[model samples]
Target: MRQTIESRQAELNAARLRMLNKKQEAGDRRQEAGDRRREAGGRGRWTEIA
Candidate 1:
């Protein structure tokens, strides 16, 4: 019975780690998208001025 409980706990921990990794990846993608928007906006302003 105790072994079963330990195994279940280990599975839950592994699932939690996977979820955290996914969240980190999503955040990195969001940062990259923001960087791209900022770069595009800068170019747009330069074109408007010219």
Candidate 2:
């Protein structure tokens, strides 16, 4: 019984780790897009202001 519980806990931990990794990847992608917009002289920001 204890072994079953430990295995289930391990699986949950792995799932949580995967979710964190996916979130990190999404954040990195967003950061890269922001960097590109900045490199383009803030054209996107200007449009938002207008």
Candidate 3:
């Protein structure tokens, strides 16, 4: 029973780690897009007044 619980906990931890990594990747993509837009021009394409 103890071993089973430990294995389940390990699986849960792995899943959490994967979720965190995915979140970080999404944030990185957003930052890269912002950098590209900034490089092209200061005004935001999405916003009308910026």
RMSD of model 1 against the true structure = 6.3
Estimate the TM-score of every prediction: 0.73, 0.84, 0.84
Q: After superposition, how far is residue 36 of candidate 2 from its true place, in Å?
A: 0.5
lDDT of candidate 1?
0.82
lDDT of each: 0.82, 0.82, 0.83
User: Candidate 2 residues 11-48, lDDT tens each?
Assistant: 99999999999999999997777777777788654322
lDDT-sorted candidate list, best first: 3, 2, 1
| Winner on lDDT (1 vs 2) | 2
User: What does candidate 1 score on TM?
Assistant: 0.73
User: Number of backbone collisions per candidate, in order?
Assistant: 0, 0, 0
Model 3: residues with Cα > 4 Å off, grouped in runs? 47-50
Candidate 2 segments exceeding 4 Å error: 44-50
Error of 2 at 38 (Å): 0.2
